[model samples]
Target: MSKLEDLKTAVINGKRKDVKTIVPELLESGADPVEMLEQALIPAMSVVGERFKKNEIFVPEMLVSARAMKEAMKIIEPILIEAGVKPEFKALIGTVEGDLHDIGKNLVATMWKGAGFDVVDLGVNVSPAAFVQAIEEHSPHLVGLSALLTTTMPAMRDTVEKIRGAGHDKVKVLIGGAPVTLEFAREIGADGYASDAASAVDAAREILAS
Candidate 1:
């Protein structure tokens, strides 16, 4: 395989050191940053997510690979910004109130970033009021709420309600986590539900298309 393909393999294998090394070599060899991102990093993460969903890879593997992808991205992000490669969409993401769990949230955030959305991560234990405030501040096209515990799930509903109540009805709300289900997402009136990161990209695209 070629070096670009090797970069993809490095990310897939979760070789952070190799990913860091390869990115600069690729750049020095006159590879386009946008092409590197689109061709390698995004697709690598998407495959990782698919593996995770299929139980072919577990969370530890996913985390390392996602971390590797992030390593490459840190180098490319600046070049993209400097060259005016502004993300076509913005997504605000957070773990809802009373839920300190963030592994799932962080994974989703990283995958969203990999998918080329400018993600504003509000972090764990985010209150409904805080979600509303973030919506007011960022005006993102998509808002994602993650809750790992059954008890904390209502915070997702309340946040969604408040955002709609606040007259930000157009923005789509995407929900996910270990305990979250498709029926629950629909009952809570969310715009979409994704079981994993790769599907999250698909859901975000579908939501945007609608």
Candidate 2:
């Protein structure tokens, strides 16, 4: 198989050593950073997300794959930046207020980055006001909210309401988490919901395209 395909497999399998070594080599071999990102990295992460959703891989495996992706990104990002390659869309992502869980949020953020979107990760336990502030500052095309707790689901609703109330209805809102569902997301007025990181990228792309 080709080196790019090998690198893609390494990323999907969470091979950190291979990712660290092969990514730079690919860059040295004149691989386009944007192509590597779109054709390899994003698709690899999409497979990882599918595995996670199917319970074929657990959190630890997903975390390892994400780390590998990040390592590869460290090599490609600067090249993309130097080449004046900018994202097609910008995203603001965070775990909703009162929820400290961030693993899922971080995965989605990294996948979005791999898909060539500018992602601003707001970290864990982000409040409505903070989301609003980020929206004003980043002017993102989409805002992603994550909540892993049943109790904190309400925070997601409140955050969406606050964003809409702030007159930023043009900005699309997305919600996801282990406990979050499409029904719940609809009830909370979210524009979309994804069960995993791969689908999250698809959702983001669709939202921006519309």
Candidate 3:
């Protein structure tokens, strides 16, 4: 098989060691870093996302695959930046305050990266103030809030309210996690909701299109 296909298989198989080795070889062999990102790494993650959405793969497997792609990204990102290749869109993602869960948030972040959005991950237990500050600083087209516990739903609501009230009207809020639903998202004034990472990509794209 071709080297690009090998790279894709390495990511799909979660072969981080192979990815680390292959990425440098590809770099030395005149491979375009952006093409490597767009053609191989992202597609592998996109397949992983789809499998996760379909329940064919679970969080553990998804994490493994994402880590492999992340290794490749670590090598490719600097080259892309140095070459003046920037992603066309931006997103800010985080888990709301009082909720320490991050699996869902991390998955969505990976999917966003796969979909070519430059994602800023704010990590777990993000406060409303922090969200507002990030909005002002990043001015991202999309924001994602994750909460694994029902108790943290209120925090998600408060966060969305704070961002909206802060007059960041152009920023679209997206809500997700085990506890967040369409009704809850609507009540909290979120612009979108996705049950899994693959759909999160679709939701973000739709928000961007609108």
Candidate 4:
């Protein structure tokens, strides 16, 4: 197989050593950094996301793939930046206050990064005021609130309210987690909802487009 295709397979297989080796080789061989990102890295993560959505693979498997992708990106990102490549959208993500569950939140952040968005992860147990403060500081196009427990769902609602109340009219709020539904998202004034990491990419794109 071609080197780029090999790189894609290595990422899908979560072969970090292979990715670490191949990325630099591709760059030294005059491969386009952006092409490596858009073609090999992004598509590999897309496949990983689809597998997760189908239960064909679980979180452990997904994490390895994401780590491999991150390794490849570490090599490619500098080249892209030096070439004046920048992501078109910026996103901030965090788990709501009182919910320390970050597995779901981390997965969504990786997916957003894979899909070419510049993502700032605010970590777990982020407060409504923190979300609003971050939105003010970063001016991101999107914000994601995660709540794993039913109890923390109200915190998600409060966060969305605070973001809107802060008058950041253009920033779209996306909500998701085990207990968060489309109905809950609407009730909380979120612009979009994703059932899982795979769909979060699509939801963010759709919400931004609208």
Identify the leading candidate in terms of TM-score: 4
Best by lDDT: 4
Off by over 4 Å in 3: none
On the 0 to 100 scale, the lDDT of residue 202 in model 1 is 81
What ordering of candidates by TM-score runs from best to worst?
Answer: 4, 3, 1, 2
Q: How well does model 1 score by local distance difference test?
A: 0.89
Locate the minimum summed-lDDT window of 10 residues in model 4.
Answer: 107-116
Candidate 4 structure quality by residue, lDDT tens digits, 6-83: 999999999999999999899899999888988898899889888887889988898899899989888888888998
Q: What total of clashing residue pairs does each candidate reach? A: 0, 0, 0, 0
Taking every candidate in turn, the Cα RMSD to the unseen true structure, in Å, is 2.1, 2.5, 1.9, 1.5
Q: TM-score of each candidate?
A: 0.88, 0.84, 0.89, 0.93
Of candidates 4 and 1, the better by lDDT: 4
| Alpha carbon lDDT of each predicted model | 0.89, 0.88, 0.89, 0.91
lDDT string for model 2 (1-210, tens) is: 988899889988889999989988888898888888888888888788778767898767877888888898888788888989977788999999999998879878877876667899999999999999999999999999999999999999999999999999899999999889999988988899988775788887776777
User: 139, model 2: CA deviation in Å?
Assistant: 1.6
Off by over 4 Å in 4: none
- Put down candidate 3 lDDT per residue, 90-137, tens digits, no spaces: 999999999999977987898888777899999999999999999889
Q: Where is the poorest 10-residue window by lDDT in model 3?
A: 107-116
Residue 34: error of model 4 in Å? 0.5
- Per-residue CA lDDT of candidate 1, range 94-116, in tens? 99999999887887887787677
Stretches of candidate 2 exceeding 4 Å from the true structure = 149-151, 178-181, 195-199
Name the Cα RMSD for model 3: 1.9
RMSD of 2: 2.5
